[model samples]
Structures are given as C-alpha cells and as structure tokens.
Target: MKFHLTVDNWTVQKTDARAVRFDVFVIEQKIPVELEWDDMDELCIHAVAYNEAGQAIGTGRLLPDGHIGRMAVRSTGRGQGIGAAILQALMAQARQRGDTEVVLNAQTQAEAFYGRYGFSRDGEEYYEAGIAHICMRHVFA
Candidate 1:
C-alpha cells in the first residue's frame, strides 16, 4: 500500500513517452482532444510514477498558474493509490513554487475522488466532448 511519489519538470515526458496512457484517458475516453493537449506542456511540471518493473504507471502535470490536470494512472495500476500520489506530488511542486491555490476540471464521475484532495466544485456540470465535467478549485488552508 506504500507508493513513492516524485515530481520533476518533463519527467512524465520521458517515462510516459508516447503519452499513450494519456490518450487512453483523454482522447480515447473522449475528453476532447483539445483538452488532452495544450500550450501548458511548455511551462508545466510533470509527475510520473514507476512500478517495480520501472515502467511508467501513473502521471500528472501541474501548470504555472496552479492548474493541476492531465493526470492518469495506467489502468493496470489503479487501486494502488498512484493517482493520489501523482496529485500530491504535483501539489507539493506547486507549493514549492509558492502557489496559493490549484485548479482542475473534474469529470463528474471523478469529482469525489478529487474532493478527497480538498477540491471544491465551482459551477454546474457541463458537457465537454460528450462527457460531464465541472470546474474544481483547491486552496491551501
């Protein structure tokens, strides 16, 4: 049940190389190709996790504006706390940068998952790429 978390710039770019995991959660999951990739990559910090075999099992990215998104743990790696570890890693990076807050767009189904990290929903649910989504924000307390 113990998972190690690491945060670094462009780390995910190396381990999650092809970003196939992202394509699974973002593009293949129909989360709008636009939302899948943005200009943020150039300025964001990425967190990537490696399993016992040294393969990328989970990943996430944090933007300079405190935007935490594009997080995904390979399906096989689920239920091992990798997603939360990735989020926490990015949050730590944000804190190191003196960010006072963080924001993310949560798919309706995962809202509760993000809520555990102190994220609060800000608006009504809306459809994006045929899936329901809501804006969520988290502020340091």
Candidate 2:
C-alpha cells in the first residue's frame, strides 16, 4: 500500500523529531543515550517527517558547521522516500544560509544512499558509536 508523508522543519526540542530519532538511533540501532543526545542539538536546524497518521517517522539535523547528522527513518518508513525528503530539507536550509558545502559521517552501509545526492566519500573508514562510518561531503557550486 502507498503512504502519504510530509516533511517539515522543527525546533530542536520538538517532541516528534525526538521520538523518531530515539526509536531509530537509541533503540533500534543500540546507540547510547549520552552519545546520541548532545549539546549540538540546540545549535542545529532539525527536520521531521510524518506519515498520514501524523506519526513522526523520520528525522535529521543540520549543524551550524554545515554537518548533517542523526538521519533516521523508521523501519516502516524505509523505501518510502522519507529519508530523502529530510535530507533535501536540510540541504535547502544549508543553501539558504549560504553554506558552500555540507558534510556528514555516513554509516558505511548508507554511503551509497548519500552518494545518490552528490555526496562523495572523503576519507578512510572509521567507527563512531561502534558503527563503521565514512566522511562524505557535498560542495555546492
């Protein structure tokens, strides 16, 4: 069945966004709460995606330094374009703020996903929160 979804910018404290990230990162991915919740959240621009039932199913954030992180889409929401929508929203926010480039530490498994959006892997593989990751960057022309 097809599902309808909506993506919107929200404050860092928005509960919907927090809930989505909590489920995807902390619970599903086994990331520690301390490492998952950080001071940078207050200094970042956040976005959340909601399904037709108004349930938040995806989330992401763009930091002041042009770093995109905490990207997550609920298992039920995968393959539904929610992740792409969140990424696009964050990138638009960066472009509007005059950022010349954006970067993210993509979990190794997701490198190909970001690559589809013009992000290129920039460095050797590394581990963050016990998961393999690679730095990826997208330069705006």
> lDDT winner among the candidates?
2
lDDT of 1 by residue, 49-135 (tens): 778777777878888889887778777788888898888888888888899999998889989999999999999999877879999
Q: What are the TM-scores, per candidate, against the unseen true structure?
A: 0.86, 0.92
Off by over 4 Å in 2: 1-13
Error of 2 at 71 (Å): 0.3
Residue pairs with colliding backbones in model 2 are none
TM-score of 1: 0.86
> In the order shown, what is each candidate's alpha-carbon RMSD?
2.3, 2.0
Q: What lDDT score goes with residue 42 in model 1?
A: 63
Candidate 2, run of 10 with poorest lDDT? 1-10
Predicted structure with the largest TM-score when compared to the true one:
2
Could you give candidate 2's per-residue lDDT for residues 1-141 as a string of tens digits? 244434344463368778988899999999998888877877788887777777778889999999999999999999878888889888998999999999999999999999999999999999999999999999998
Q: Assess candidate 1 and give its lDDT.
A: 0.78
